[model samples]
Target: MMKRVTLGLFGAWLLHDAEEWFTLAPFSARKAASGGGQVGLPWMRREISEAHAHTAVALVGVVIAAASARGYRTEGRSRFYQAALAGFGLHGFSHLGMTVAERGYTPGVVTAPIVVLPFGYYAHRELARTGVARPGLRTALEGIAVAGGALAASHALAGMLHPATSAATP
Candidate 1:
């Protein structure tokens, strides 16, 4: 059950991120084209190129895969795996909130409710059932912070790898 649950995290993340990867580029393009980019918070106003967006998603995938691997090897005993699972579960809420804030469909919003939340809940339940120790609130929060920081770093790396270009000449 632990093995299945651990592996399930990777599979579910793949599905959720696949949705994000495909939609993000197009969505950002549409927003930029419509001048919707200018109407949001400073962070939202920055538009990411398709390459950068996809690369960031891929980078996160690597992190998820590593966590899943560690969980599988440790048979759910690893604190890192426990924290990651808890963090991933809670991360789904961010997607829902993003959709609400945007007042429209957002990437990963669909899968957050269906795939991410359900898998996270099921995985956590199975972990508890198997007598694996919970990561505790502090570890869970740390996991979330790590995940968020990793995402930001991935985006920065992606940007460096594929810097956004402009048609206008200086």
Candidate 2:
């Protein structure tokens, strides 16, 4: 039951990302600009670039996964939950590294990664403890992650193709 709920939440998060691709990409770019410091200053645009509605949805999925883990721990399915947590933790760490490398580690600019990384890590650890993931499940998750990554890349491309302009009347 808890596994099902976690999967459902992740599914919903994927759908939400699809829905917000257009709007969110540009918003993220703009927010990055605002957050990035002036020229020659240590800018932190990468963290800003991750600002998207889908991120909130993903966070919600993390919460659900964690709750599900707690509910299932007695069953000795901790490894499955741990794998899930590891996957997300890796994702977060990668993202954070990208952000810091592209944009200097500004104090306030690093909030998004700082908040989400530990949350995702904890959630995954709990899930591993509680769930029993099948062999096929790992493949499916990899496929889903790939597809989601592609969709996000496309959204970023679209934003670049149709650059937003302040001169254009709202």
Candidate 3:
């Protein structure tokens, strides 16, 4: 059960993020074109190109895969795996929260409730049922920090690998 949950994380992440991968660039483009004067939190306002979105998604996929593999290998005992699982759950909620805050659809919002949230909840419950140590505050915090750092790095790396065209609107 734990093994299935661990592997399921990867599949769930891919499904959730694939929504973002396909929709984010176009959504940002539309939002920019509408002159809506930035939406949601300030940090969410940055417009990105399709290339950047693709690269970032691909990069993060690797991290998710590594975390899932670690979880499977350790049978939910690895700290990193626990942190990643917690982070994934948090991230799923964030998508829903962001959509509500924006009062509109956001990339990955569709899958957040369907795939990401459900999988996160089910995985955590199964892990607990199987005698895996329940995640503590430290694990949750670590998950958030690690996920944030990875996302930042992925964005940075994407920028470097796929420089924005000057003609591209901000």
Candidate 4:
């Protein structure tokens, strides 16, 4: 049951990320400044190149898939899973903050409420349902670090690559 639930969250995250890569990145690219960059968190910034956005999405997908495939029922595994839930929950809020900060739409905002919320809720609920201990602050911090690093790396890598698409394309 824990395995299934964890896998489900991973699947949803993959889909949510797809929305960002396919829809959000391309859409936001048009609005990004031509000469100057915007300010925000590394991953949640307004000027992320499309290549990096897609790369980041793909990397996260790989991580989630690997985590699901490996196993998530043990004590350490449960801690990571719980932490993932909390981290993802925080990620969702980050998107909301991005939206508010920009005073407009932002990449990942569309799916944040839809995909992130339910998955986080169910992931946490399923973990609790299965008797997994809620992660402590340390575990939560670890989760945040892992997720933040993965996402920030993706953004950095995207900047290194060529643009995935032109701003003219719809």
Which candidate leads in TM-score? 3
Model 1 agreement with the true structure over 8-83: per-residue lDDT tens digits: 8889989999998988767776666666553332224455667877888999888889989999999988777777
Rank by TM-score, descending?
Answer: 3, 1, 4, 2
Better of 1 and 4 by TM-score: 1
RMSD, candidate 1, Å: 2.9
> Per-prediction TM-score, please?
0.89, 0.37, 0.91, 0.78
Model 4 TM-score is 0.78
Candidate 3 deviant stretches above 4 angstroms: 36-43
lDDT for 159 in candidate 1 is 68
What are the per-residue Cα lDDT tens digits for candidate 2 across 4-86?
43443354334433433334335445545566423321112322233333443344455435534553553424444434433
Q: All models: lDDT?
A: 0.78, 0.41, 0.80, 0.65
In terms of lDDT, the best-performing candidate is: 3
Look at candidate 4 and tell me the lDDT of residue 169: 28
Clashing pairs in 1: none
| Model 4 CA deviation exceeding 4 Å by range | 34-39, 42-49, 71-76, 161-170
Candidate 2: worst 10 consecutive residues by lDDT?
A: 40-49
Give per-residue lDDT, candidate 2, residue 80: 42
Q: Write the per-residue lDDT of candidate 4 for residues 97-146, one digit (tens) a residue.
A: 87787777777889899988777777767676767647568766876886
TM-score of 1: 0.89
CA shift of 161, model 4, Å? 4.4
Better of 3 and 4 by TM-score: 3
